[model samples]
Target: VWVRGALRFSKTPNGGEKLLAAASSHKCLIQLEDVAAESEREEVVARYFLKQGVQVIVYLGDITKQEADALVNAANEDLRHSGGVALALSKAAGPEVQRESSDLVRRDGKVATGDAVMTSGGKLKCKKLLHAVGPEKDKAGGRERELQVVQGDIIHEKTDVIVNSTGFKSEPAGVSKAILTAAGPPVQAELFNGQKHKFIYIHSGLLGCKEIVHVQTDQEAQATNKTCKKVLKLCESKGFTSAAFPAINTGTNFKKVEVDPNSVEYQDIAKGFHKTAKYKIHKIERVQNYHLWSGYFVMRRKMEMKNSAAELGEKYLYHGTSAESCHCIERDRFDRNYTGAHGASYGAGVYFAINASYSANSRYAKPDPAGLKRMYVARVLTGHHTLGDSSMKSPPQRGDDPSDKYDSLVDNLQSPSMYVIFHDDQAYPEYLITFI
Candidate 1:
């Protein structure tokens, strides 16, 4: 038989239609081999699967022969085999597929969340049937639980997945089904919305696909670049719109350094963003933790490293002179930077880096002098809207005279700041401060 411009010939002495007829019957192990003059037909089929975003499951051995309990079906409550794997199954099982699903839906009206229906294996080798609702936003705009049910079953290992007739409106039937297929049964079945569900973990060998990469210094920056490239390739391969990244290799991976204003690492993943989808960077940190303080300082030290993936207009230029020693200290202080009164203010924006011990006593301990500049800038930008250093727990009395041109610069109140406060003087802390 020919479909989508691909010729199909059966291994048995029969026409292509006979093979399709056998598939429709769901007859066990209808093995067939390509008989075209060339393998162009096979290429066409592969391209068809790709166009639809379907993940073709190829096992070295028989899959259906394996014994398993429940088989999970990605079925619409409508029970009509419409598109995706559903349509494929319906075609394979003849009309019996629709008959069974229709019978179940008749009894259930519409399946509720976490609901299922059982059916005979029919032509397929499996036994009891399960019809669970994947996530869906109905026509009325109410949330449905389709994803929770399908995802849950896919990850169960005990259950085999049979996805069918599911799709998002914006995608073609094949493409939507394919993405859902790739997400696997776990994400498909698991409910990740308002309700709570059991935590099911599956190791797809993609580094579990959920990990944090902490980067804190120039050395750490090198490692982070490599990781970013690797992650970008992974996402590209997967056709994902975006991937979230935690500041990688920045915490435990870099050398220790005194935290200072010049130490923040803020490079953009420009390479990852070149694709149609935008990538995001999630800075995961523990506030008020001691070890976090050290890592934050280390990252700040490496912020200046040239990033291979930095986006255009995303890099920040630093022109301030380094003040490593007391003797070399020049025009350095928190208030001085905020007022734009002392440092080279050509166009440097403000950044905060916190490093400290997480101990309660150490939490409030005074920050390092070098790192104090970051805290000071953050405080000025986020907390108090003063021209310079001033307490915000209480604002300047309305009638209080503008003591100086600096005090007169106070604009609106309640502007937020990004300040990093580390508690440990000698080591990184467990938490960093984000006082706004």
Candidate 2:
């Protein structure tokens, strides 16, 4: 009907003024306080009449000040009243309103896009607050782009594609493991069994998303960049409008160089090899590497600076591989893609042994045609590790928190003979030992 704000009747209207005058007696008028006298005398902007004999009036002013029955709040899915109109409404309604809104989301889950939920307006003029989640920009084929860095769990994001970073085998680890855990076992099964492509797509089962794009990445800047590009391309090809990615390859990168034979470092490394190796060392060639050794030192220094309770847990370990793989390791550093080349009893990672004899097994150090066996003396970062199993694709969480994870995995925590490192940069090949 005829709700009054600052209503002004038109004098030039043909019969509009006469009809409004006739219905003026039946109009329901609401007097708003502190309005300018001139504003009260302004002409009506526009009006529409429905078939049910009701008149709609349009008014422009502060929405929070309006004494409407319900106020619609443009809110995120979680109903966080942080900015813009949502913040203003929440401020006007007081903190209790936000608590009520959060309680609603917690009880009924997030409000989906194009849908809404209602909460009682605490101190606001409106009686009820309608929290509505709107569609993201570019979702409906718009050209504009929007980027946001949100600090929270990625699994809670509602996007067309959720990226899961893994090794070449597409086995879940780190963030990928968390994603798979949330997505349920079926998604993990499909991830392993599905045909290999540039990227693997698994249905998001229990996850609050549409699909999961598992991309293989190693602890290298180049690999991270390549993974990002592939993910974008995959999303484009699949016609997905939105995707979520966690911090991929958040580890150091290393380069290998041949160490000078006359250097003192070389003699010390050779002496250590002579002390540890069970087999007779035919030769010990020191290699200059900046990743695992330097990375371990950096982590140790950082821990000391922060005065963290955990120790760095640095250990000199040995890894045995075939001649071809040895060359690859020397060239490009340890690649987690070949994680299970020998065995993955501890975990799917680059395995190292505290005892050289353990790694010197024929199964690991495959003999060449000339019967020469090769092993690497690597400085491994085994910071706060725990016992791991064959099923583990990554180190388990430190405690109940998923974000805080162990730096490495071991066969035994008390006396770890074997250490498994998921991140490639966590270990560096310092010396190459050739023995019969």
lDDT of 2 by residue, 120-167 (tens): 988888889888889966666666545566744576577988987777
lDDT of 2 at 300: 47
- TM-score for each prediction? 0.19, 0.38
Tell me the spans in candidate 2 whose CA falls farther than 4 Å from its real position.
Answer: 1-267, 289-310
Per-residue lDDT over 19-71 for candidate 1, one digit per residue giving the tens place of the 0 to 100 score: 57777898645544444533432232232246668755433333233334645
The TM-score that candidate 2 achieves is: 0.38
Clashes of 2: 0
Model 1 TM-score, all chains together: 0.19
